[model samples]
Target: MLKHGLDPADRRRPDRLSDRELADRHQAMQGFLTVAGPQLDQLYNLVGLSGCNVLLTDAHGIVLDQRVSDGDAQQFRDWGLWQGADWSEAAQGTNGIGTCLAEGRALTIHRDEHFHTRNTAMSCMDAPIWGPDGRLLAALDVSSARADQTERYNRLISAQVASTARAIEAVFFRSSFPGARIVVASDDPSEQAMLLAVDRDDLAIGATRAARRALGLEREGAIRPRPAADLLGRQDDLHGFDRGERAAVIRALARAEGNVSQAARALGIGRATLYRRMARLGIGDEPARLSHD
Candidate 1:
């Protein structure tokens, strides 16, 4: 705080963005906000009745949206926890929102853990949210100034805050690749939301941060396109079956005279499943015309 020239005893509120600047920032994050808005509301619904307020902030710690009860709005506003408030570590010292963004992690700052004396009455639990491209995107925070709030209760809220952040990241990732198929890269609950986006040709198009880390992709940038089967290390029968499955599919298609539905019936598989198998085996729509009937 000393290096930042902040006095721990200072009672002045943190600086805020002007209406014009705030509007511009909001516009910049409009897409993410649109996707994450429902998750934010769900989080608020979970904790709002407990005398807590839920806030979502951009990577710079400027509050983008907040949910607070009508009765406690003035108290939270007076404490500089409203929209447009600047809570970057340089501005607010070691508070939850600022510190979570600074450290890129989930944590709790309870009561006097606040750097500013006036903010000591509030307790905050926060988690850092990652964008679809694996960069720092935003922070999700739950805060309370209730006199009866306990550290134990804050810990519980902290867990929910972290979970909600991951949910937002998952929703944003899926929305980012509207045409791609999302595959769960990991079944571990700890790796919940570890997902990969694969195109129609089974080429990996994108990955969530956890998926990127799990699959050895670059940690902080766009992932290069690669074969999803290669990344997943699955035994795709295209080459692995040594032409057996491919030959069988070819024979079936030839027998059906290029009608995919008829071929699927001969192969005893669903038409969509046959199409997927054909795609996996590099089969084209123009099947061999072995027979007119």
Candidate 2:
């Protein structure tokens, strides 16, 4: 704050967004709220059973939504965990929401880890929520009053919050492309894995940040990242569709039961386009056989 001309000693006086600013933030995050609201409510109910309150904040760290067990609601509010409060690192110093936004990942800020002295009475765990296009939309946090049990609870809640964040990403991805094929690329069906949206042109249209990282989809530009592909050998198409496109085609076909029309529809491409891509990629007469081979 020294650089910003604000005093760190003035931490007691909280800052908040104005009505116009709040409204703009709300409008900016409307779509994310629509998908996250109901699911977060369910999560709050479950997590609240453990005496923790749940909060959702925008990318800017303004608490957009909060849910707490009635008995603990006042306690949480007293700690400044209510909606519309600006908890960005600039405003509140180090905190779960603020720190997570700064770090861009899952985190748990225990007592004394908080920069402001007043907020040291609580422990917080948070994870970033990403949008369909792989941008950060918000963060989900769980906070509990600090006590002897804090260390144990922080570890448990951190993992749960991170899992919930991934579920939120799944919702955003599926809602963004209702017609595209949703493929779980990981071999383990029960584990949280990379979910890919295969587009009509036999290419990947969307992938969660986790999937992108797992597949090594390096950032090509700010607006969009590149596709993930298994490294192919000599059979790989050079001038036409590459390994990435081939993998997407195989996965889509496998899920669609080898029906060219169904696979084409799932990829959001026409039957002719699917055939053309397959032909150009040097796929032989038995394209369905390619998936098994």
Candidate 3:
């Protein structure tokens, strides 16, 4: 038998919301929905093929928008799994949105994993969506049936959905916080962080703080005066490194166990370049690996 926590069969109670609280959540969702526009439609089209039901929920866990397969929507609605329904464990029982918010992390809740008996037939993957200041703004979830679900497949789809959500957030931040400084902080300081500061025209004006920290700067002033590309440690010979570069660095560090040489080798970049990129990206230093020689 699988261990309780490891087996994904654990039951968790939901937090019940008052009518007044629900009304407030509804109002907040309406604000977000008004701004959703084309991006929401685009996301619906992109994830339509995963045979998954997509939902956007406010930080409070009320569903704002739901995009389900045409035939499946009715069935889900009949089951009380429809647009505007609450997905938080507190209101609806143990569920994806509630558990994710409760834990404040990305999660996958598989068949029979929910605390509520009614949710046993569903599998869900959810990731928190953050605002420019890194506040929990919303959650993006993809839910499917248990009949054809696998842990691996759920993870894959969840990752894709999370990536799309992140892209959307980047756009949201650019639009909502124009000319404001934005930084991404990680638990692992060695991991490259991204700093984005856009001008009123939606063009990047500066990238400090998180970007400097990603680049391994010790003092704050080290990166304040430098160009974003220079801080990122990209060579003048090459074009600007995009978002993928930061993702690659994070992946390499994770895979190589924070060994600079190993990560550089895995990334197919010279150690110097990797070091420069790390410094430019605001990745903190990892423990030096002992030489085998």
Best by TM-score: 1
Ranking by TM-score: 1, 2, 3
Report the Cα lDDT for residue 179, model 2. Answer: 82
TM-score of each: 0.83, 0.74, 0.56
The per-model lDDT (C-alpha) reads 0.88, 0.76, 0.63
Q: Which stretches of candidate 1 lie above 4 Å from their native place?
A: 236-293
Clashes of each: 0, 2, 14
Task: Give candidate 2's root-mean-square deviation (CA, Å).
Answer: 6.1
Reference-based lDDT, residue 278, model 3: 76
> Which tens-of-lDDT digit does each residue in 244-278 have in candidate 1?
57767887886777778888889999888988887
Better of 2 and 3 by TM-score: 2
Q: Pick out the ten consecutive residues of candidate 1 with the lowest summed lDDT.
A: 284-293
Summing lDDT over every window of 10 consecutive residues in candidate 2, give the lowest-scoring window.
Answer: 225-234
TM-score of 2: 0.74
Regions of model 3 farther than 4 Å from truth: 1-31, 34-37, 179-193, 198-293
Writing each residue's lDDT as its tens digit, candidate 3 over 1-293 gives 22222223334323335667656776765645555545556766876666667887878787667788887787566555555566765555557887887776788888767766667888888887665445667888888874877888888878766765665565565566555545433445432225556333223344333443455643232223334444444464333464446657877887776777888888898888987897777666755632111
- Specify the poorest-scoring 10-residue window by lDDT in model 3: 1-10
Residue-level lDDT of model 2, residues 146-264, one tens digit each, is 47645876788788888888888788778887887777767776545367776655356677776667666543212242332331112444534476677677778878777778888
